[model samples]
Target chain A: MRLSERELVSLIRRKLARSTASEGTIVGPGDDAAIIAPTPGEALALSTDAIVEDVHFRRRWATGFLLGLKSLLSSISDIFAMGARPRACLVSLGLSTWASPLFVEDLFEGMLKAAGRFGASIVGGNITRSNKLFIDMTVTGHLAPGNAITRAGAKVGDAIYVTGHLGGAALAAKHLFGGRIDRGRLAEVESFLRDDVAATPGDAQVELLSRFFAPPIRAEESSALAAAGICTSMIDISDGIGSDLREVCHESGVGAVIEIDSIPVFDRLPGSLAINRRDMLRLAISGGEDYELLFTVRQSDELRLQRLFQENDLCPITKIGRITPNSEGIVFLDNDGRPSEGFTGFDHFSTKEEGH
Target chain B: MRLSERELVSLIRRKLARSTASEGTIVGPGDDAAIIAPTPGEALALSTDAIVEDVHFRRRWATGFLLGLKSLLSSISDIFAMGARPRACLVSLGLSTWASPLFVEDLFEGMLKAAGRFGASIVGGNITRSNKLFIDMTVTGHLAPGNAITRAGAKVGDAIYVTGHLGGAALAAKHLFGGRIDRGRLAEVESFLRDDVAATPGDAQVELLSRFFAPPIRAEESSALAAAGICTSMIDISDGIGSDLREVCHESGVGAVIEIDSIPVFDRLPGSLAINRRDMLRLAISGGEDYELLFTVRQSDELRLQRLFQENDLCPITKIGRITPNSEGIVFLDNDGRPSEGFTGFDHFSTKEEGH
Candidate 1:
C-alpha cells in the first residue's frame, strides 16, 4: 500500500522470490516493506522512497530542515511498522539550479537530527541535478529474527488496535489548496496561512501544523511490541485508517469491523480541530498522515497487551476494531451499529498539483 | 566527484564523521564510495545514486531495458571500485505519467539481468509519481575483511594500471549532441543515431553503444587484486582519467604522470571509435564512463600482479602511469615525453538539459 503502488508490484513480487542475493535474507519484497538479514538471529529491514516537489511536498510550505526531517522520519516509519530499530539511511538529493549551499546544509541538519534521534546515521548517498528538488531516501533497520510483522498475518479473530491519534495532518493540509503563491512571499504567506488556519477551531496552530511537517516517531513502542511477539499484522497509517486499513485487510485475506464511537478523533491534543461531528468523524477515519501503528493482536492476549503498555509506560493504545472473515468486507458501525459512508483518503495520484 | 558536484560536498564530509550509528563501521564518507560492515570478517558497501530523465539520460535514445541496465551497472561500478562484489540493490522509481507498466517491467528485466550476473538481486524499493522518470538506486556489496581499497592509500613510486580500454563510450557519446527528437520518431531515430554513428568512425555501433549501456564488469578483477593486497589505491574510471586521477592524488596526497602513448584508445574491440589523433587523445584523457578499475600497485608487486593475471587468465590490463610526489601535480606526457594539453572531462552540471 506504500505509494498506493500499481502494476510493477505484482510483477516484481513473482520474479524476485526465486532470486536470493544473500545467504541470510529471511524476507523479500511483496510481503514485507524491506529485505535483509545480518544473521539467523537478526534481520535487517531496508525501505526506500522518493518524495518529489509538488507531488509529495512543497518547498513553500515548510523549511528545508523540516522537509529533510520529515522525509527521513516518514520513510523510517515503515521500519517501525516492520518492528525494527533504525540503524542508518542514505539520501539522494536531486537539486535544481536555484538551490544554494546554505539550503543544502539546512536539509542535512534536519536529516541528521532525525537520524540521531533513533541511533541512525546518514551512511552514504548520491546527488543529481534535476528540474525539481527530490529527496530519495533509503533506511536500514534491524530486528530480532522471526519478529517481522508483515501485513499478511492478521487472523479472523484478532482484535485490531491503533496507537496514538490521527487526523491533524490532514486538517492542516486542507488549509492549503491547489494554488501557487508568489515566490518572494512564500515565507511571509506561510505564516499568514498558519494564522488563517488558527482562526478556525484548531486553535493550536503550531501543534496541528507540526503533524504535516513531521511524522510521529513510534519505533520504540513498535520494537518493544515486536520483541514481545505481539503484533499479528501491521502497517504505518500514512494514507489514513480507511486506505491503510483496507491494505491490511487485503493482504491478510480478511475483513474488519470498526466501532466508530471508539475512534480517537485527536482533539484533546490542542482542543477540537473538527468544527462539526461529521468533519471530525471523516477526518478520523480517512484523513491520512497520522504515521501511527495500525496492528492486530490475538483476542486472548488483549489483557496482556494492556498490562505491557501499563508496565512499560508506553504511549496509550486503543482497541478500535476487530478482524472478520474476508467475505464480511471492511465494515464501519455507527453508534446505532448502522453502516456509514463518505470515507475518502488522500489520493497521491490525483493530487499531483497539490502540495502541503 | 560523483556528479562533478558542488559546494555541499566538504560541508557534509566534516559533519558526518562524528555521527556513527552502527557498531561495525570500518570506514565512512570523504574516503570511500560506500559505508558499512557486516562483521569483522566481511564489509558491506552501500552506495546510492539518482539518475533523472534528461539530466542523466535520454528516454528517446535508449529503450527502457537498456536504461535500467545502464543505471544499475553504473551504480554498482562504485562497489567494485571499493573492492566488493554486489550482493543486493534497492531501487526507488519516480515514474512520470508517460511511463507505461511495460516500460517498468523492461527496467526490472535490465536490473535483474545485471544483478544476477554477480549473484546480486533486487531486494526492496518504493515507487512514486513524479514529473520525470528517476531511478534512485542503492547497491550493497560485500568484501573480505581488510580488503577495502579506498582512494586514500596511494603513495609516491606506485605504478598505475587501468583495466580494459577507454574512450569508446565517450566516442560513441560524441555522435550525440545537445538536441531533441520528435517523440513519435524516437525508436526509429535511435537506430538512425547508431547508423549515423556507424557510418563515421566506429563500425561496431552495437559494441560502442554497449559500453554506454552496460558498464564493463571488473568486480572479479578488482576483488582479486584487493585480496592479493597488490593495490595501494583504486578507483573506477567514471569521470575520465583526468578528473578521476585528480581525485586519487588529492586524497592520497600524491600526484601522477600519465604516459599518453600507453593508453589503449579502445579501437581493437570493434574498430576505431575515434575519428583522428586529436579526438582520440582527447577522448582517452577526458571523455568519461569507461568504468574500468584504475588502481595503483607497488613497484615490488608489479611482477606478482603480472603473474596473478597471467595465471588466473584475467582481462588484459595496461600500465599507463606512475604516482609522484604531491608537488608534481597530475601531468600528462606525450610520445616525445613532453607535457600535453587539451583535456576536458564531462561537466554534468552545465549540460543539465543535454541528455545522452
Candidate 2:
C-alpha cells in the first residue's frame, strides 16, 4: 500500500529513535525548524542531491512510496559512502501543483521507510512548488576525533576488493524498462542474485543479482574491517568497478594494473541483461550506483580480510590491482599485458545531450 | 571570467585553509567514500536543497559563479536559521553536457567564497552527468547544550521581532528581471543596498538582505541574544515574515495577531525601483528566502532586547505581533481593523505556479 507523507514522516521518526541529540534536541521533528546543541570544536557534514521525475525514475514504474524511498536512499547512500553513520536527513521536495498532500506524504513514507532501516531521522526539510516531482535530501553525520575514513588512504600493493556483485542493478534497470515480471523466472534469477534478504544458500549468480539490486552491507563492516587492521583505503562502488576504483587510485596517487580476468562477472544470468562479457567488465568498471564498499588492503592483511569475510558471510574479497606511484597514472591492463584506449568512465555533464 | 570546477575546487580548498578532517577527518575529499566519527547522544541538524537550472535561477541573470555561491549560501543559511554553526557540507552536482570543467569550477569558486565567510567546509560530494544543471547540497551543524533554539519555544504574550527588513530581495529580483544594467544608477543602488553588503547600518532590512544573499551572521550576536536572555523563541526568516511567523506560532501551538502596518518595510529604495507598498508588504510577508532571524521575546525581556539592540547599534526591534491561544489561529489585522481573507505565503510546493 502507498503511504502518505505524514505517515512516512512518522515512520522516519520511529527510526530516529536512537538519536538522543544530547538533551539538546529542543525540537526534533513536526516543526519548521529543529533545535540542536552547538559545540565549539564540532563540525557538521552537509550534502544534497535531487532525484528528478523523468530523469531519476518513471512514475508508472514505481509507486510514489518507492520513489520516495529511493530518493532518501540515494542521498543517504552518499552519507554512507562517506563512511559516517547517518544522524539526520533533511529533505527539500519540489512537487507539481497538481500533487496532493497525500502524494507528498507517500513520498515521505518511502523516505522514512528507508531512513528507518538505517537509524537516521528526518529532522526538518522544506516542500517547494515545482512543475516536476523532485526529491532532494541533505544528510548530516558526526565524526569524532579519529573515526572518519577518506579515499586517500590506499598504499602501494594494497589489495582491492568489493562487497557485492557488479551488474544486477543494471539488469534490474533493464527489466524495469521492459516491464515484465515472471515469479518463476525471478526466483531462478534470485538464486543467482542472492538479494541478501536472509542469505539462503544459493549460487553466485543469485548472490550477484541480489547484491546488485540491494547490496548487503553497512558501515559496521568498515569498523569490523578496520578492527581487523585490513583496509588501507576504501570507497563505495556506486559507479562500476573501474570508475570507482579509478577514484581510489587517482586520489591515493596510485596507478593500478588490473587483470580483466580477475573481475567477478555473472554469466549464468538470464532475462537478457544488457552487458555482455566484454561489456560486463565495462559495467563492472563503470555502471554507477552500486553502493558496495570498495577498499584496498595491504597484501599482508589479506589473510585477516579473508577470515573476517568467512566469519561474517559477507561477499568474498578479491585482489584486482595494486596502488603504484602516480607517475604510472591509472591504467587498465588486459591479460596479455597491454594498455587500452578510451577510459572516461562517466561524466554527468558530458552526457547531458543524451538526457542523463 | 568564469572558473573551472577543478580550479574552483582548488580555490575553495585554499579558502578553507584551516578546515582539516586532520584530527578526525578520516576521509576528506576526492574519494568515493569518506569515513567519520559517530558521536553518541548528539542529535544532528541536517538540511538539503537543490538549486536547479531554470528552476532556481536564470543563467543570464546570475553568473555561474554566483549560482555556485548561492547554492552554498542556501545550504549554510539553513544551518544558520537553525542557529547552528556549520560543520561540514556535501555537494552532489548533476552537470549539463554543455558545461566545462571550468564552468563547474567557477560555480565551486562561488560556493567556496561563501563557505570561507561562514567557516563551514566542503567535506565531500559527487559529480554526475545530467541533461540539466543541478546543484544539491546538504549541511550539518552541531548545537551545544542549552543553545539550540526552536520555534516551539514561543509563549503566549510573547512579542515578535525580525532581524532585517523585508521585501528588498523581492524588489531586487524584480529589477533583475529587466536585465538592463543601469550603470549610471549603479552607485545609487549599491549605496542604497549597502546595508545588504554590510557597509552601513545594522538594522532589520540590511540584516535581512545580507542574510538573504551573503554569509550568515553567526556566533557573537546569537550568543549575546541568548546571554541577555531576550528571545523566547527564534527562527531565521528564510520564508518571509508572514509565513515564518506563522510557522513559529503554529509550532508553538499559538495563534498570532500581526499588525500589517507595524511590520517593517524597506523605504527610500529607488525611484526606478517602482515597487508597490502593499506589494512590498506582500513580499515581506509572502516572499521566501530571506534567511533573517524571526524571534519572540517575553514581555519581561523586552527592555533587555532593546538594550541589546542599542548596544549592538542594530535597528530597533519592532513589535509586529503577539502570540495568542491556538484557537484563534493566525490573524493579520490592518490599520482599518478588517480581517484578511488570504495570505500569500510561499509553500515550496504551493508556490510552483507563482513564477518564482
Candidate 3:
C-alpha cells in the first residue's frame, strides 16, 4: 500500500530506532534536526553522495535492500578514505509516487543494517516524492587531531597499495546487463550465483557478480592505516584506478608507474566465463565501483606497514605501483617494463559506451 | 551544453573557492570529505531537506537561483529552529541529462548567496545526473553549551508566539499558481508583482505571492531568543501552525487553545483577493511555508520577552495562543469564544487537491 510522507517518516524513525544511538548522538531522529556531540581533539569529516535509479543501478537488477545498502556504503567509503570513523549519517530519499510502503521499509532496513555494521547511527533524514528513486546520503565521521589522509600528501617515493581484489564489480556488471540472464529470473539467478559461487571457488562469473552486488567497505582497514600513520595519501576506488589514481597524482603533483603484472585481478573464474586475461586486466584497471581503499605509503615503511596489517588481520594489502615525479606522468608499465596505452576509467559524461 | 561531471565539479570548485573558507574548515571542497574543526562547548545540530522539481517548485515559475536559495533557506531555517548558528552546508544535486551548464552555475550562485547571508559556508557537495532536478541540502550548526530550547520544554501555561505575519506564503502561492498569471511570463510577472505591490499597500495578491517566493528566514531572531533564555519551546512554521503547533504540543505533552482574532494576518490585503476575514484567519492558522518562528514562552515572562525582542530589534513578535493540558486537546476559539471546527493543514498524501 502507498504510504504518506508522515507514515514513511514514522516508519523510518521506528526502523532506525532499532539501531542504538552511539556516543556522539546527542539527539537522534524525530526532531527538527539531530544534535551530535563533538568529539574533543578530533576533526569532523563530512561527505555527501547520491545514487539515482538507472544512473547508478537498475531497480529490476537489485532489490531495494541492496540498493539502500550500496547507497550508504558508497557515501561511507568517503569517510573511510579520509581515515575517519563514521559517527552518523543523514539520508535524503526521493521516491516515486507509486513506491510502496514495503519498499520503503526494506530500504530502511538495509540502511539500518549497514549503519549497525559500521557503528554509525542513522541520526536524521528527509523524504520527498519525485519522478524517480534516488537516495542522497551525508556521512560524518571524525579522526584524531591532524590525522586526516588527504589525496594531496603522496610523495615521489611513496608506494601504492589497494585493499582486496579489484574488477569483480565490473565483471559482475557485464553479466547482469549483457543479456546473459533474463530480468524475470533475476532473483533466481542471484540465488544461483550465490550458491554456485560459494560451492565452487572457480565459478568466476558467479563470484564476480555476487561481489558487485554487495561489495565490502574498507572502513576498519582505512581507519587502522590512518591510526598507524602509514598512509600518506588515500582514496576509495569508486571510479576505477585509472581515473582515481590520476586524481591523487594530480592533487599531489606527482605521477605513478603501475606494474601491470602486480595488479591483482580476480582469478578464480572457470574457463567457461569466456573473459580473456587481457580483458580481465582491463577491467581491473578501468572498471569502477570497486569500493576498495587505494592508498600510498612511504617506501621505507612498506615492510612495517605490511607487518602491521598482518598483526591486525586486516584486509590483505597489495602493492601494485610506485609514485614518480610529475614529469613522467601517470604510466602503466607492461610485462616488458614499457609504458602501455589505451587505459581509461569511467567518466560521467563520456560518450563512449561502457563495457558494462 | 551538457558538461561532464569533472567539468561541472571543477566549475563548482572555482566558483566556491571565491567564498572565503571560515576558521572551522580544515579542508574544503576538493577533498573526498570536508574536515571541520569542532566548536568547543557546543553541540552540533544537523538537518537534511530536499526540494524536487515538481514536488517543491515548478521549474518554469522560478529561476535556478531562486530555487537554490529557497532550498538552502529551507534547511537553514531548521538549524535556526533549534536556536543554533549555522556553520556549514553540503548540497547534493540531481539534474537531468539535458540540464545546461549555466543552470548549474545559477543554482550554485543562489545557494552561495543564501549561505553567505547566514554566515554559513558551503563546505562540500555532490552532483549526479537524474531524471529531474532536485537539491538535497544538509545543514550543520552549533548551539552554546546546554542551551537548546526544545519543544518538550513548554509548560501548560506557556503562551504561543510567532514572528512577523503568517499566511503570506500560502496567499502568494494561491495567486502564483492560480489563474491570475501565466507560467511563461513568470520572470516579467515577478518583477511586476514586486513593483506593483511595493507601490500599492493593498495589493494583497501580488504581495502574498512575492512573500512566498522570497520568505525571509528568522535565523538572527531565533538565535537571539535562544541567547536570552526566554523561550520555553520553539519551531519553524514551514508546515503551517496547525500542523506545527500540534507537533510542539504532541512533543511537550500539552494542548493549545488558539485565539482566532489574535493571529497576525496580513491586513493591507484588498477585498478583491476574495478571502473573507474568516478565511484569512483560517489561512493564517493553517497556511504552510511561512518560514516564521513559532515559539512558546512563560506568561510571566511575556513582557520581558517582548522587551528583549525590542532590544534586539528582531522581527515583530505576536502572542497568538496559550498552552493547555493534553486532556483539553487542540482548540481554536472564534471571536465569540465558540470552538471553531473543520480546519485541516497541508498533508503530503491527502487526496484533496491543493489550491497552490
Best by lDDT: 3
Residue range B136-236, candidate 3, lDDT tens digits: 99999999857776767788999999998888777766665565656544564345533432233344555555566557688778888888899888988
lDDT of 2 at A332: 76
Which of the CAPRI classes, incorrect, acceptable, medium or high, describes model 1? incorrect
Candidate 2, chain B, TM-score (2 decimals): 0.81
TM-score (2 decimals) of chain A in model 3: 0.91
Task: Give the per-residue Cα lDDT of candidate 2 at A128.
Answer: 46
Question: Mind giving the per-residue lDDT tens digits that candidate 1 earns over B126-190?
Answer: 66677878999988766664677778789999999999889877765565433332333334433
TM-score of chain A of each: 0.80, 0.77, 0.91
Q: Mark the regions of model 3 whose C-alpha exceeds 4 Å error after superposition.
A: A177-210, A270-274, A352-356, B178-210, B267-279, B351-356
By DockQ, highest first, what's the ranking? Answer: 3, 2, 1
Top-down TM-score ranking: 3, 2, 1
RMSD of each: 11.4, 5.3, 3.7
For candidate 1 chain A, the 10 contiguous residues with the lowest summed lDDT are: A1-10
By TM-score, who's the top model here? 3
lDDT of each: 0.68, 0.60, 0.79
- Give the 10-residue window scoring lowest on summed lDDT in candidate 3 chain A: A193-202
Error of 3 at B80 (Å): 0.4
